[model samples]
Target chain A: MDSMMMGAMTQSMKSMPDMAAMDMSVLQACMDACAACEQACTVCSTQMMDCSPACMNCADMAGTMMRSMLRMQGMTAASMMAMLDACIAMCQTCMDECMQHADHSDACRMCAQACKDCMDACMAVKDMMMASA
Target chain B: MDSMMMGAMTQSMKSMPDMAAMDMSVLQACMDACAACEQACTVCSTQMMDCSPACMNCADMAGTMMRSMLRMQGMTAASMMAMLDACIAMCQTCMDECMQHADHSDACRMCAQACKDCMDACMAVKDMMMASA
Candidate 1:
């Protein structure tokens, strides 16, 4: 997210008490991770491997997680946590599935890496929220 | 998704144990609902209301849900259920938030309606899975 968009979002989200104190950098990192993971998974799914379904599911979940972060005004700490947990689970599942073909498929390898990155990013957000709380 | 794409998907997913038995019509309806909800939420987010965040989140979730349905080869019954539950929760939250301003905003009203429809469509898929299981 750009500063201009972030400015607009922050301004619009003044009604949310928790959002006011949220770290934009942490949120932005997670969004970026989600976007990357979604792209990787999309490409991996095209390979028609056994992991294709998991890749597709991860891609969607990651995209949703990114968008949710972008629209933080709609989130409570609890909702955010739940969403993060779900994202992490989906990523982990995808990564596990993709890793099975990592040696045979470059796309699966890359997708697995992306899922790991996304999981780490989501965990970071969860950690930040916990610390803040 | 078109019949051609659906055909391709079904062909590619032949390796999945359960996907062979899945009903395309039920999955297609859910995908359509998800796509509609995503669009409605995207438009609603542009309104910059308090619900914008939730709308954005819902939009992403709905899109992801739709795509997951399209790529059913990667899904297991358990993962599908988890994804559906998360999607339902996100839609319910978005609907609740959007309904608050429905009287003043057509976008919000449409978004809320879309969320409700998506929720119902997802529930139908769940019910179908349960009946089959």
Candidate 2:
């Protein structure tokens, strides 16, 4: 995410009662990861692979994470936590599925990496929240 | 989610660390909400309201939520919670924006309703997790 967009997101998050107090950088990274993962997974899913189901799911989860960042008003701390868990789960599942054919397909390899990155970002966000809580 | 699909997802989730022990029914509801909201938001976005940005974001988030449900192996409890938060946040943002036009547009009204339902489902998942923990 660019500084200007981050600024816009920050401005938006300020209205969310529970999110205003947290680190925006962490949130930004997670959102970016989600966006990147979505793109990668979308491209990968188009490929004919047995891992298509996982790719599709990862793409959806990543997209969700990105939009969630775009709109913070609906979130509470509890909901945010649950979302993070789901994203992480989705990524891990996708990564594992993609890994099975990573050697044969570059798309799967890249998608798996994106999923890993997304999982890390989500986990970082989770950790940050937990500390504050 | 059909019993067959849920059964497939359950079998997949067994490999995950924190999710195997969790309730699948709550997860399924959340996933279904995400899917419905995504469809609602996508159709609503074509309406060209000032709420378009919010609608776009909501549509993306709903897609992600749906995908996450399809692939359960990648999830962890923490990530799931965070994702739920993000989805709820996105839906709330879309709902609020769409509510501004609800009186004039049935699509916006329906979109808002979908977002609300999705938020409720996400919160239900979060509450269920907390009880388990």
Q: Which has the greatest TM-score?
A: 1
Interface RMSD of each: 1.8, 4.8
- Chain B TM-score, model 2, reads 0.94
Top candidate (DockQ): 1
Instruction: Give the residue spans of candidate 1 off by over 4 A.
Output: A1-15, A18-29, A42-53, A104-107, A127-133, B1-15
lDDT per residue (tens digit) for residues B1-77 in model 1: 68997778777667667666668788888888999999999999999668887888888778877877776766667
Candidate 2 global lDDT: 0.80
Write the residue-wise lDDT of candidate 2 on A1-133 in tens digits: 7898888878877775778788998988899899999999899888864777667777876776677667666455665676677778778878887899899999999999999999999999999989988
Model 1 DockQ vs. reference: 0.45
Scoring the B chain of model 1 against the true B chain gives a TM-score of: 0.94
Q: How many backbone clashes does every candidate have?
A: 2, 33
* RMSD (CA, angstroms), candidate 2: 6.0
